[model samples]
Target: MARQIFHRSTSTFPADKVYAVMVDPDQLQARLDELGGPGAALLVYAADDGGVRYRLRHGIDPSRLPPMLQNLAPTELRIERTEALRPVGPGRYAGTVGVEIVGTPASITGTLRLTDTAEGSEFVIDGTVTVKVPLIGGKMEGILVEHVQDLLASETAFTQEWLARTYT
Candidate 1:
């Protein structure tokens, strides 16, 4: 079975500005430097009238993994992540995100929605964490969900700070 993951965060910056920063390679690299575990890098970034798409690689320190998962995971979990965003309407955007744990049977797929709010923009993520393991797949999925939640919170905070510093 797959585990569900959901997260929502609001930004004081407008949706357009938030989307602009998210799609910028330099801004994304800065975010990785701050929150991405180790050897994290932006592997691909492209933007056009169609929308924006980027790929990133992130490394997860083995020490951070739960004891039960440490045995099943590599010394460092390498994750390849891809995100794409397209305009849904004026001041609104919709996106899709996918993540794969290299050399592991774990993956995550999600949808993102950015809608304009009076205060700024509301970002929402709806996703599932799937692990194709035997007896421990559920446990692993739970762990991953927790970690992803934490990571999303951190990224939101970072983006907010960046917007305040850069735009304010």
Candidate 2:
């Protein structure tokens, strides 16, 4: 069975600018570095219409995870994440996003929406994490959900700071 994870984040930067940084190779790489910390590797990068498609490999140390997860997951987790949105109108993009875990039955797929707002912009992720493993898929999904949510929070902070410094 699969579990659903919904996330909402607000960015003070406009949608276009946020999208710009997202697709820029240098900026995106840097952000991945921050997300992946010392274990970040950029396997691939491809520019898309409103966003980009990229693959990142992260060496997640076992010590950083609980014993249960440590045993369930490998020492390294490589995720191929894709973000491609078509322009719906000014400052708005709608597209599908997906995350695939290498060598694992776990994967995430969902809708990614970016829209301009009075504050600046909003990002909404409605994703489902599926683990085909029997008897433990639900528990594993909880762990993955928390991990992904943390990643999103970290990226949001990074993007906000980057926008402030880069845009200024």
Candidate 3:
């Protein structure tokens, strides 16, 4: 079974500035260095008329995960997250993103939207964490939701700090 996760955050940076930070290679690499655990690196990046796409790789200790996840990835887990965002308007973009954990039955699929707001940019992520291992899939989903929620909170703080330093 798949469990749903919804996230929303407001960034003090304007839409264009926030979008630029999201697509900027250096910013993302730095972001991973700080948040993506040990040896996290940007694996891919691209830009086109439509928008931007990037992938990041990192190592996760399976022992730190929930019992079900640890069972699925007994050893260290390699995480690959890919995201693609395309411009929807002057200050809005819609995209699909996914996280792939090698050697595991769990993956997260979702949609992301970034829109301009009076104060700054509104970021929304609506998704589901799907675990294919029967009898424990729902449990895994619950754990994943908590993990993702924490990650998002950390990311928002990082973005705000980075934006202030780089843009302001």
Candidate 4:
């Protein structure tokens, strides 16, 4: 079974600009590569008038894990079957992401909402990870939640940098 997690962040860019960069295949791929590392690969599984489909794979560095659960770290955090579904909206949009971690039957699903604001955009990302492991699973969940938050913060920073460079 999969759990649901939700997260949200607001950006200093309009909805249109944010959406443009998000749905742009090239931009998405480039950003993923930059964030996920050299081993990361993104595939456009589908793209049409409706929406876009993407598959992403990346290697996770165990060294990145917090000291508490370092012993429980998997050889790598392989995220497979990751998909982003984008739905149209009025001055805002929503997306859902599905991810599977390697060596574990558990999977995670994330929900993201982006809204246009007067000065920028608001982004919300919620993620839930279900693991088969009993005791350690809960702790792992906490770690994952923390990791997701960190990733989002880093991504927001990257977006800011990208926008500054592109606009200026």
Whole-model lDDT per candidate:
0.91, 0.79, 0.87, 0.69
Please write out the lDDT profile of model 1 over residues 18-76, one tens digit for every residue.
Answer: 98887878889998998887889999988999899999999988888888777766588
Candidate 1 error regions (>4 Å): none
True-structure lDDT of candidate 2 = 0.79
lDDT accuracy of residue 108 in candidate 1? 100
Question: Model 4, which residues run further than 4 Å from truth?
Answer: 1-4, 66-74
Any idea how many clashes model 2 has?
0
Residue 36: error of model 3 in Å? 0.9
lDDT of 4 by residue, 75-104 (tens): 666666556656577777777788777676
TM-score to true structure, per model: 0.96, 0.89, 0.95, 0.82
Off by over 4 Å in 3: none
RMSD, every candidate, angstroms: 1.0, 1.9, 1.2, 2.7
Clashing pairs in 1: none
Best by TM-score: 1
Residue-level lDDT of model 2, residues 1-168, one tens digit each, is 899999888988899888777667787778877787546777777665545666666556667876666666556556667766667899997778788776778899999888999999998999999988889878988898998898888878888888888898
